[model samples]
Target: MIELRSQQGETVDLICRRAYGRETAENLAAVLDLNRGLAALGPVLPTGTLVRLPDPPADPPRVAVVRLWD
Candidate 1:
């Protein structure tokens, strides 16, 4: 688990992207679950608000790519 303070005009998505390099639905939900009442604060969190973030998944999901020209 990682805890970080919110910067001015920072949102959850931004935080997740900064911490984990990517923001996905799973991570967003996980972060919300970890920090209760965080969503109630609205989109832009107040500066200095404490947020708890879950650790990144050990193995990120892989997406299969399809070649348009083969």
Candidate 2:
């Protein structure tokens, strides 16, 4: 599983984009159904808190899974 870390004021969308690519924020948001307030992302994720970056999924299936942040 990938570890999602927040960077002062980092949003769910920003996490996705940074972990994957520039165009992945929105897509990842859609996958998580989190349009706003991504602070509830994990047990360790706090608002504007610094966290780790989840690893990007490999090619083939192209699935953006929130499980990575576990």
Candidate 3:
């Protein structure tokens, strides 16, 4: 687990992106689930608020396979 303090006017999305390196919709939702109280606070997060970040997966990041053309 990682611990970080919230900066004034920072949003959870920004925090997640900075902390986890991936701010995808799924990741954002997962963060909200972990921080239930912040979910209710919306985009603006108070300064100096303590936030806990979940541990990153031990495995390497997953790669997506994209399809191009039709």
- Candidate that scores best on TM-score: 1
- Residue-wise C-alpha lDDT for candidate 1, range 1-70, written one tens digit per residue: 9999999999999999989988999999999999999999999999999999988889887889999998
Residue by residue across 1-70, what tens digits does model 3's lDDT show? 7778888888887888788776777767776767778766667888887777777668747889888976
Shift of residue 2 alpha carbon in model 2, Å: 0.9
- Per-residue alpha-carbon lDDT of candidate 2 for residues 1-70, written as tens digits (9 for 90 to 100): 3455477656666666676665454456453543244445653346555444434556624567677575
- The candidate maximizing lDDT is 1
Name the better of 1 and 3 by TM-score.
1
lDDT: worst 10-residue window of model 3: 51-60
> How far does residue 11 in candidate 2 sit from its true spot (Å)?
0.6
Backbone clashes in model 2? 6
For all candidates in order, the CA lDDT equals: 0.95, 0.54, 0.77
